[model samples]
Target: MPGGIEGFDRNVFINCPFDKGYEPILQAILFCLIYLGFSPRIATEANDSSTVRIDKIRTLIESSLYSIHDLSRCQAGKKGEHYRLNMPFELGFDYGCKQFFTDQRCDKKFLILEEKAYRYQAALSDIAGCDIKQHAADYQKAVRAVRNWLVSEADIVADGAAKILGAYADFQEWYYERQLAAGFSEDDIKDYPTSELLAAMKAWVALGKPI
Candidate 1:
């Protein structure tokens, strides 16, 4: 099987925009995943141009028992700008993998997120009936959406969403101070590699942040 890796059940494949504009929501989602004791995996975790990018993504999909796909960037942001399709394309691939792979793969779960409810229908009409959680461009809302979904789908017993959001807020302040103390400028911290950011989050959670 393609998903023979250890800890596959706790792996979560996150598919979202990597732009600066989406950082806050992305970070919130990441924090929620880690706080709930799930490992979040993304395409940026590795840089192997020698291997086909789609193959890497397919491997990630096969290895993750759950996935969260944010299609908020499906529409163009500015005049004449091209719409982004990568998010939905990967979502389709993940769904296909679960459907056509072994029986264990069919147990895979997914959560689809958007900036506004029903907005995705305008562009991706094929997924019209699927439940799409709306974050409305609010990072806290995104955290809550992820928290509630995990609780319901993964059978996780988590603190209230407000409490988790509060912990994230505290972590943000601490992360900034610590990063600055380490001689990283604001831009440097903001643009830090995603792997490093994930490690920092894991370290912070290891300190027993009341999540």
Candidate 2:
């Protein structure tokens, strides 16, 4: 949506929580998508407090041919915490878009991710018939799930998860050095934004995904 439909066929809408706890898996997903030559679209790519958030997200979903929905953080972790609905909410919108907009989005595909086995069945029983993949809070498993999904649904020939993980580690080191050389402090690196990190991953892949 940000760049129009130029890369719509290779664009992937990422629906997940934006929090410190989910950062690792989030990075893994971003790196995997960029490494495999796909564009990863997430709400954080822009920081416009003035813009209506759901409208921005719907624009992204409509522009993407594929999506990855993570329902891992839907359940509240503590007794007083309210469960999250944004992830599942966007996922439903994407599904409905594909089903209702037959002419424009009939071919859209999505992958559902959970952190635990059969967890969605208890809270989101309507999706019981859909196949969901669990990551168990492991970045490597997340990479594998994303890689396999892209391969199967998008017909992409890609590197295996382990190899991609190794390359991801290499990119982190490369990016850290580059940022420091450009005068970014260690603290700055630690606070790197996901939107910026996605750009760095694309640059790393462009440079041949050096290891």
Candidate 3:
């Protein structure tokens, strides 16, 4: 007899005491079989030099910017709106009243400009809910529109100053003081006026704080 499991009588093994050590041995055998069964293998003959170059070229194409993002489903978030990549680009030209007219004498001019910006923001927020699959085109269009605005009309100087020079401190101080006077707790004005909140944001940014 081989002095191992086989050495034991067949009938005796059937009624043998349970060994916790046997469990680990059985588990290891199963693990080995499963790992070997699924081991990956290269198919067929090795690739020639030309085939290797072609494979590299295919990989480059797959990684290009034009191939990276699925433009058909590309979407961008702007202000509060979501835009689909497939949508037609439409510039909100009507929203730039402040830039179009230099006249500050008109009382309604500033109001209209403010309203326009707010409306644009609201419009963008509405887009944020657009389904990416169904409105992919629309999202792309909106993204382009937003990009144009950010590139052409953004008040880069004032915005940078507000963000880097604490120029918006007056707005925040006034807002904070007003909230205090109104008996509102700090938390109460958490979502206060957009202008006031953004002003504070600019001050924070100016202080080199992470947004």
Highest-TM-score candidate = 2
- Lowest summed lDDT across 10 adjacent residues in model 1 is found at 1-10
lDDT per residue (tens digit) for residues 43-66 in model 1: 987766798888889888889989
In model 1, the number of clashes is: 0
Q: What local lDDT does model 3 show for residue 204?
A: 44
TM-scores, each model vs. reference: 0.94, 0.95, 0.22
Clash count of each predicted structure = 0, 0, 16
Shift in Å, residue 110, candidate 2: 0.7
- Residues 30-134, candidate 3: write the lDDT tens digits: 122112221111111133456663343333222211110112212343565555422112111112322343342111110011111222334345433332222
Best-to-worst order by TM-score is: 2, 1, 3
For lDDT, the strongest prediction is 2
lDDT of each: 0.89, 0.90, 0.27
lDDT head-to-head 2 vs 3, winner: 2
lDDT of 2 at 10: 90
